[model samples]
Target chain A: MATASKAAADSRANLPFVYRQYSAEQLREVLHKMYLIRRFEEGAEESYMRGLIHGTMHLSIGQEASAMGICMPLAEDDQITSTHRGHGHCIAKGAEVKRMFAEFFGKTTGYCKGRGGSMHIADVAKGNLGANGIVGGGIPIAVGAALSSKMMKTGKVVVSFFGDGANNEGAFHEALNMAAVWKLPVIFVCENNGYGMSTSTARSTAVKNIADRAAAYSMPGVIVNGNIFSEVAEASHKAVERARNGEGPTLIESKTYRHRGHSKSDRNRYRTKEEIEDWMSNRDPITLFESELREFGFIDDRGIEAIREAVAKEIADGIEFAKASPSPDVSETGNYVYTEQA
Target chain B: MDAMVRELSYAQAIQEAMAIAMDMDERVFLMGEDIGVYGGAFQVTGDLVDRYGADRVLDTPISELGGAGVAVGAAVTGMRPIFEFQFSDFATLAMEQIVNQAAKMRFMLGGEVSVPVVMRFPAGSGTGAAAQHSQSLEAWLGHVPGLKVIQPATPYDAKGMLLAAVADPDPVMIFEHKLLYKAKGPVPEGYYTVPIGKADIRREGRDLTIVATSIMVQKALDAAATLEAEGIDVEVVDLRTIRPMDKQTVIDSVKKTSRLMCVYEAVKTLGIGAEVSAMIAESEAFDYLDAPIVRLGGAETPIPYNPELEKATVPQVPDIIAAARDLVKGVR
Candidate 1:
């Protein structure tokens, strides 16, 4: 018993978070994608403030590392179901900035033709099952996708992304349990962003980490620092590999903080500005990865500036393109009610 | 071309439809609790596991929410998943997936994709499974816009409609009454499809029109038989698909008969009958009506365990006869 326990502890202590060195171009592309999501969300907030974009927006400003890292290893056919704060997931999964901005701007050019706005944006053609409005709503749907993969022998994997608040939903438990039972190829990525709108994980979640609950479903559960791209990448790569190998699902608790409030309407009364500042100044994923790449001799200070300039121009251009896009005709309102009624 | 015809029960017919569909399409699979070895809670999926193996005929965990969620997930990923709810009453556990996810995914996603999922619910009150196990929730499912809600009244429809639902691109909810499963009818041997949203004239007459669904159709047919002896002709239109409503058939029948009666096993208030009533009331049939539209549905109460009380809630043959007499006699 002592030897067995010691082996488990040693393996747990030696988690493989070593950064996989990539080409200068590959690193630049990844950093560039992260920059795109950050600026796109900031633009959405700016548009909301200016009364150009209506309805609510859930920003994934601080959680970009987890999104890019987790989706990096996924195939184009691999599926993902993200939460309300799913702009990062959608962008990381390769959604165009123009279409995303167009969605926020309520244009027909948007992924959902201005009907879904931000919370419901999706690109099913790109294998993004959707961004759900309801918390934990996508878990079961992702599980269903995984079930299809297993039944059809499609050799595809599904990643179900939800917040810490969503971890408390019955869907989370039900989906996880079934996925485990059937050995469905699913990776449940819990973005533990501390707060579910206003309620803190400490106030609501019973476990120390969301991954601890995975044991109930008889699957491997691991915690990774979501702020560090390497950790998320390594953890997700292993999980995704497990899924592809037909070993079944894994529960990954990506412990990260949302740099912005839960949604656009929050006033920051839930926590101190000091806590938010601590995360931003100390653990911002974009800056941390930039510094890491610099240390690795991947790029210099000049390269960083060029990347930033490129992304800023892309964001401005995308926003302008979205502004030029038209709203859907009222005639299209009733077309999708059913699939042509058979 | 003459096809082989065999008299099969509703359960056998449904099983045959799934078997033929699975054979024709490798993408089709069945998922539900106890459907594999146990053959399903109501034995509607008997011996399918033996023929299709455990992979195609899956026995899910006893979590309806989880089972339904996985089925929804599978359906969207290019598989024709026929998910069975043990009873219509237990569908409350799967409302999130059925209503929010399945019915709204295509519309919410701007029609980029469609969920070709088929969910079968053994519904209506006849078995002493009481309130939790016997409820006609088709009206509830029919209210959702992006769903094709079907109620196969006869063995012929039970077979044909199930095949058609598998072919539909949108989510289709098939409500099979527990009592209808054992009722036998002539089903064709090979693959065929009954057109969805099209009503079938079970028995045609001229004096009055009876629009009935599921188990209520049989009762209405018996009532039409009794009304024949009373010197009043009746037209029986079996509404196999409820969501599409077959409004044109009912309207045309009412126009011909000049009287309308809508019957279902759900609660009388805001039921499918109400929709049938309003359809005629708002259409050209309204001008041809000799009397007000009569809707005979179950009483607005939970189905009791006692066999007599259970039978009392919904319209029996005698109750249908009495209601038909009142409507034809011009009694308000």
Candidate 2:
């Protein structure tokens, strides 16, 4: 017990003062969320290839830290609005993985009751507001949520997650300006994953750093190493702390990369294989966390194997649950069209 | 024996209705650009900020999208927000928030939440505001699902329809004609909620059924009276709510009148009139029609800054009268 306590304290002390140390069980929960997102995306890709899933699927393959890092600092009641690439954020915010899978499968057991596909899953019970398909759409919504929190005196914060493409949208500027003026409790996380669909951010945006835009709004802007889980976690923790302390919103530009194409159909015409291989081999967040834990003597090879096996089993169980869930009734298509109760 | 109540302008009726609703429900609040201190662009929200504090009657910045988004979020979280657009033309700026977010959230969320927000815009022409500030875009919103569109033409209907919009569980877009704000009529003094998705018969006759909306409703009634002098009895119908429209009322009126004419301030092509004409043609009343469904709407050209050109753009009283006369006489 003393050894485990000392290891946990050391891990906590190593992190920035903004982060709260987790017990072994809490650490397992965070790991479970990350693994669920990874497994869910893998399954979705397989299903898409097999023609079981229609429309586009924006996989959060190599950008798990951007989700888990930001979510770890939020309270259960804090709200979050996500972008089209949103499965990781939803999983991190405590949405049921099985239900999310069912949603992708268009089953009635889905979070949106099969009405919303992968890009628009919402679980209001879990404070996961919803995912938006439009670029920069969720920014204003998150600010509105923060306004609601302040008006209702809930002491809750809202996190708006979007890609680099959203930074150019007009709503992004308007939302940030309003949030700053009102000093709303919100966090704007820009997952600058190199590319927005086929276009690279370098060619699209004139500014090298998206975080620098926050200076115009008078908000604290920070850049984090999105591939390094600990660094990403440290940045998010500080931002969330500032929000919770009523110090207004923070803008975090997480520098990361996506292993997969923007959607299922792209053929990697833009980037070189060497670049992809370098990030996959050197900056993989899961592998880095595992190696750090092992070096700290927190777990041995057997324990690591056990963790992998548990994650695999959990994912397998979620897939089975999703497969068994029934599809939504076609006659009920117009059921939720309006809430007028007939 | 009933006593005659005092007559009030359409703007006055709307103000009275909002005041009554605000006094009754604490959750109800008014918000818009220039609504507070400025008393609204049309002075419809006159002295509201003074009567109610700034908190309840908010003056937003020039950000229409932000104001609309805030209203939507607030509506979903249990507040009844009555958001005003300075003019219906400015509503285009907030279309993304209104059409995408507020209109679809309930359906997307599996009916878990309701957006009880009322967006009031001063629509239609005759104000000489021109182009950007003068346009009728209710048909655009009515095309979208999960939204209730209302156009109140009379003082009584304005008060009753506004109350109904405020009490509605879904988002309602109330399009008030800029020309009819000063039009005066007798209105009862009290809280009354008229049912939406229903049409009111302004004049009943057997010659023809003239379906109109917003400013055209008054024009249609005027045409009906003129046609009545010529022994051409015409029935006029006011389509208060465009979406969830009163198809039954229009069909019944058309069946009885055996002739139909749809009038609107929108363009002649693909306007609300086109939809109503199609509905009448498709319904069982098709066989009972005495003449083809005639639609009198605005010309397909931009509303020019010149007052004469602007008048030519939309259906005026004379155009409605001429259309009614021609349809009744079986002349195109």
- Best candidate (score: DockQ): 1
Task: Flag regions of model 2 displaced more than 4 Å.
Answer: A1-20, B1-6
Listed per candidate, the RMSD to the true structure in angstroms reads 4.6, 2.7
Q: What is the alpha-carbon lDDT for the whole of candidate 2?
A: 0.85
lDDT of 1 by residue, B1-332 (tens): 97799999999999999999999999999998899989988788899999999999988877777778787778888889999998888899889888888999888888877899999999988889898888999989999999999999999999999999999998999999999999999999999899889999999999999999999888888889989999989999998888887888888999999989888899999998899888888999899999988889999899999999999998889888988899888777
TM-score of each: 0.96, 0.95
Q: Name the candidate that leads on TM-score.
A: 1
lDDT of 2 by residue, B191-265 (tens): 887889999998899998999998888888887888888999989899988998999999999999999999999
Residue pairs with backbone overlap in model 2: none
Cα lDDT tens digits, model 2, A1-342, are 011365557666755332335555555555556667887889888877888778888998989877988888788888899989999999889887778878888888889888888989888888887888878878888887887777677788899999999998888888888888888899999999999898998899988999999998999989998866667777887888888889999999999888998987889999999999988999877777667656655566887777778877876777778789999888888877677656
Backbone atom clashes (below 3 Å) for every candidate: 3, 0
